[model samples]
Target: MYGIYIYNSKNRNITIGTKEEKKFSLDIYQIYTHDPLEELLNEFREGQFSTTLTSKQKHMLLKMVRKNRPAFAIDEEPLGKIRGHDIELYLDVEIPYPPMLRRPPYPESLESRKESEKHINELLEMDVIRKIRHKEIV
Candidate 1:
């Protein structure tokens, strides 16, 4: 299991949780990850790879993240509600809501659980997912 913690980047850049050799990447506004999982996620979020770019060139990448606001607004408290957004604006849209049921978590072996725990811890560091105090199905 491996993950990266990018201090400042749009999309929160989360890679798919995988069971593999352990590794991690660290970034400060600028980021470069040498993993296929992250590379693919980057394409969907920020664009392409620039691994060969010089250090000075890498700084240009900082501009790619969303400016003036954090990207994890919906991932914050009372999840899915962005500040200043009026629900009325979406009244006409047929938004897909989650079913009101609690499915048991899939069974996993110890090794798999350990791997997932590491990945979840990494997500905590990046604020891609925050702590929840209670469980409520909606």
Candidate 2:
């Protein structure tokens, strides 16, 4: 993925909720692909953003991407994860607990089940979540 942001600034002292309220307007352009850097450069040459971006701005954007190309490369494999921090779940209720019915797991194909297990394993390996072993009451 490649991204470029351009900020438009009118003046230094900007007031709130005034005409200059929208002083800092930002233009963000992004391209998501696994193509090589050379191909991406060709895309820019072919005027991918000719209408919105000036030649100089486009050149600078492409130059920045080329300079930091290694950081953009990502693995093709998909993994389930929440990147930043641990997530907390809280249930806020004032009513008393009520009886609930249990249902069996949804039916799925062999391939689908394998895919689910693979994602679960990945999450477990990352310590993002833990597996719970439940005993059914008959």
The candidate that achieves the highest TM-score relative to the unseen native structure: 2
Off by over 4 Å in 2: 1-40, 43-47, 66-104, 119-138
Question: Best candidate per lDDT, number?
Answer: 2
**Model 2, 16-70: lDDT tens per residue?**
3545334444344566667554565785564355578866676688888666544
Taking the tens digit of each residue's C-alpha lDDT, what string does model 1 give over 2-121? 554333454343343442343344444767657644443454464455789764454444444333235423234322223454343233434363443345677999999999999888
Q: What is candidate 2's TM-score against the reference?
A: 0.32
The local lDDT score (0 to 100) that residue 88 gets in candidate 2 is 73
Cα lDDT over the full model 1: 0.51
Clashes of each: 0, 0
Assess every candidate by TM-score. 0.30, 0.32
